[model samples]
Target: MAGSAHGDIPLTTISFSQRPNGTVATVTVSNPRKLNSLNTTVLDAFLSCVPPLAQRSDLRCVIVTGGLCSVGQQAFIGGADISEMKDFSNAEAGRTFINKLHLACKALRNLPVPVIARVNGHALGGGLVVMASADLRIATSDARFGMPEVQRGVPSTIEAAMLPAQIGAARARRLLLLGDTISAQEAESWGLVDKVVQADQLDEAVEEWVDRLLKNGPRALRIQKKLFAMWEQVPLREAIEAGVWEFGTPFEAEGFEAEGRRMMNEFQMQNRQRKSRL
Candidate 1:
């Protein structure tokens, strides 16, 4: 449980812990002063911490969550630190600041394995965009979500564009344009969050997702995730063609064909035994 500092940014900490089985990694974000907000310093630390985890050979899934609140409540990311935005006087400076945030989000999305947002508290503005970028999201019932950037005099950009694909254009507009925060149930109903549970059940819910993802073939899962991202940008016919290409990629990987043949043989054997028993 010993944590290390990222460079000299002691207040902003990113910790990673691998499960005993080595299939899952849990990344905890802690910045107690701002409810785990992503300031420039924190964005740097996050960019440094995530890319290596994404490249791990043994990793199958990732659970990203914020540090715990004092009362033992799970404090998921609050959003980008507004305090840091107050002094921005030029377009170039603003662009530089936003690019760092984009890099952090890109690292999470680029992970070959599924990245699950374990949302246990408020996820606003850029925080909501981070949740949107995850392959899957599970949240506590009390978790709140919004795109409040408009209220702060800034438009939600970067991965925030993923909102429409996540919750449909209409619902994405409600949050992005109106700056409305939705309850966890509402988020699920809108298809923003995949699952919602009680606060105490959050960890169990996340484990369930990790277990389910781990059950899939790792190469197939990686291909599927890659295609899913590609689908967002490509035309329908091209996307279908990409899927066909990915379908054949597993066979190109050594031993995949042999494994598939073995599994099919086992399935056929089981069917024959069942018929004989009948």
Candidate 2:
């Protein structure tokens, strides 16, 4: 909303609301006073709350968003709180800040189900990385996305490292080096986000994705999510082999074996139905 993240309105916090029988969760980070900027309070809340969703058997999808402002702009998350960071006196304080921010995003990345970033407004600096951590991103047409940490005299670190993969290295460099914000359309075209819709259509677009994801087998989604994260850190050949190895687990590992069998039976039934008239 402004050039600096120093304003204050409501208390910084993160809240999770489960919708429609607990299968979908919407985690909203509210710091409207600062345009939903990330600070210790909200980031700590995120780190504490998000990782536990991985254990939710009833949870099918998570929509991470910073709710829209009064004027209906997506104030999704405005980045780190400059006032807090400006007061940090030493390297240790900075490292501590980075660690918390990194862990919060790591929690998002490690989620068992798909994470959809419901980008409503300003996702800049740390906010951009938080959006990048999601499996999919649905942004409002007026959403603003970028990395402006350089302009603030700080290097974008931690999850910012994922930007080159999210958007290209050159594009990520453009934002980081120039401290510029890109429009939602540009972000989608550059691969920084997945979908862009008008503000009025944001929730509908997100729900469409959520519904599609909910149709998949839960065990398959969880296994696939774990594998996707692994693929990012391993060699290409190794990643492929790991997928093969991972599928074998469903044949006899832990609690997934039974669910895998059930899915197989369903698949067989569907195949048979396809051979006949519905």
- lDDT per residue, candidate 2, 1-278, as tens digits? 11222444433333445555357877777777677888888777677678887887888888888854544355888889898999999999999998998998888898888999999888988888889899999989888888888888889899888888877899988988998888989998998888899888988998888878877777778899989898889999999998988887666755525767767788999999999976
TM-score of each: 0.88, 0.87
Clashing pairs in 2: 74-120, 74-121
Q: Report the C-alpha lDDT of model 1 over 1-278, residue by residue, as the tens digit.
A: 22454432323344455555457777766666577777887777677778887677888888777775444344588888888888888998899999888887898899988899999798887778777878899999998889888898889899988888777899888998999998999999999989999988988988887877776667767788899889988999999998887777656635526444554567899999999999
lDDT of prediction 1: 0.78
| Runs of candidate 2 exceeding 4 Å displacement | 1-22, 70-73, 253-257, 271-275
Q: What is the lDDT, from 0 to 100, of the residue 130 in candidate 1?
A: 76
Error of 1 at 23 (Å): 2.9
What TM-score would candidate 2 get against the native? 0.87
Cα-based lDDT for every prediction:
0.78, 0.81
